[model samples]
Target: MSTLNIRKITPTFGAEITGIDLNQPLTPEQEADIVSAIAEYGVCVYPNTGLTDQTHIWFSRMFGNLWTIGGQGTRLSRFDYPHLFEAGNLTPEGGISTDEMARKRRAGDRLWHTDSSFTKERTTYSLLLAHEVPAEGGETGFADMRGAYGALPQAMKDRIEHLEAEHSYLYSRSLAGFPVTEEEVENGMIARHKLVHTHPGSGRKSLYIASHALRITGMAKEEGRALIKELLDFGTQPQFTFNHYWKPGDLVIWDNFCTMHRGGEYDDIHHRRDMRRTTVMAYPPPPVVMDPRFKDRFDPAQFEAMVDA
Candidate 1:
């Protein structure tokens, strides 16, 4: 492990880390340092030059168990890897989504939200790597929810401090007019999370509102949604965000627990935009220890031949 050189990109919570390569397996100490970096700063960018798909999976696994997204318009990043989700317009056979409704559903991603917020499992972090980028647009922006919470009025904070929000992918998909079946909704695609979350590592407070947060629990839908909108607008103000322009092999890792993010619109039809992401779970179940690869992991390791850091 080598010492890392970090440059803060934003005053509140984003940093660029240099002096490590993702292509190689990480030492335990290096993994700890990288994890610590994300804890202190809401986002960390590591240039993954010459990185392979396997290497990306290997590095991401060091953080924790990766979250697999299923159901409704999910295009797998790679057929062999279910943990990696494609964040682009291209299809499994390599073509863009031509359907306007399908494109709109993808476009709904433009709304600021945390990844996998609708899931029952806690999403700790997200590692996104740019494979192919466009000439312009397609920038990913992140909001400093910790900073957003810090700047809130005491009265407002008191009002929302203990409230919980019911998050649902069904609700968000509806916002984009993406059709879904009632059976899918009944399959348990909804969850409730604290409106405000405390980072386990630093014990700092953060506003956890997002587009997936459909309504506050036990409150009128309209009033709860209005409050959610208000908080999202406040958190995304320019002063609290850092908009990242992607470069090839640029790996941006963000702490999903303390921030909100969105994909920027680009020339998807004329220009191709390809990206891949692996989401790490915050509270994973105990590993099936019988599987050597999952020594202390939650889910069974996908590639057991690879060694853990």
Candidate 2:
């Protein structure tokens, strides 16, 4: 492995890395450098890597265990690869899907979020590869949560230091106007995570709130919503964000522990945009303690059993 041609895309958080061949296996030193880059800069982009589904999954596994689309099964999956998430507007046959569920899931991606936050074993990294892109728009915006935490007022920092929040994908999808069914709610897709976290890899404090974070644990629902909104707004300020305009063959990786991301708008109906992603799970959070307030909606025993395996 030779020296990586690293260039900072912004003063705060993103970097564009070159001189690495995604088609081949990476050396230990090369892997270390990439991990270091992620710790310091929340997002890294490799332009024109030309990674296919296999190579993309291979490169992602070099980091940690992958979060597969298992619970929902292959019914929602577009590609033959179960570990690779179909994040684009197209179907397996290379046509835009008219499925209502697929459309709503894409709509939920527009909100700022950290991948797998609503799961019991949250994800640490997300590697998104753009196989095809629209002629215009469809950029992904990333916000540095580490920087956001540092910029908070002392009082705000003191307040959220030991707080915890409840995250639910079922709830988040409903925010995008996806009608929730009784059966889906019975699946118990809720999780609990610290409101403020000390990232073990980077040793930096970061805000862990996202669109999936529906409410603060033990707090009034309205109050929790206000606080979560305020923190999200502050974290996603212009200075803390970097938007990546996609081009075919571009691979972008982001550390979910230190950042939040959202998909930018494009004419998905008119033009095809095929993006695939592999999520790496790491730093397993604490067990989800059932909240009595939401007992009617979630079963704690079911959540633990589903996640433990």
Best by lDDT: 2
What local lDDT score does residue 26 receive in model 2, on the 0 to 100 scale?
84
Scored by CA lDDT, what does every candidate get? 0.81, 0.84
Q: Candidate 1: which pairs clash?
A: none
lDDT of 2 by residue, 1-309 (tens): 435888998986899999989788888888899888888888999999978877887788777766656555555666765577888998778798878888887898999998889976688899999998999999999999999999999999999999999998877787787888745754767899999999877899999988988889999989999999999999999999989999999999999999999999988888889999998866432344543443322223432343354
lDDT of 2 at 60: 84
RMSD values, in order shown: 3.8, 6.7
Among these predictions, the greatest TM-score belongs to: 1
Q: Candidate 2 overall Cα lDDT vs. reference?
A: 0.84
lDDT of 2 at 264: 92
195-241 per-residue lDDT for model 1 (tens digits):
98787867999998788887899999899999999999999999999
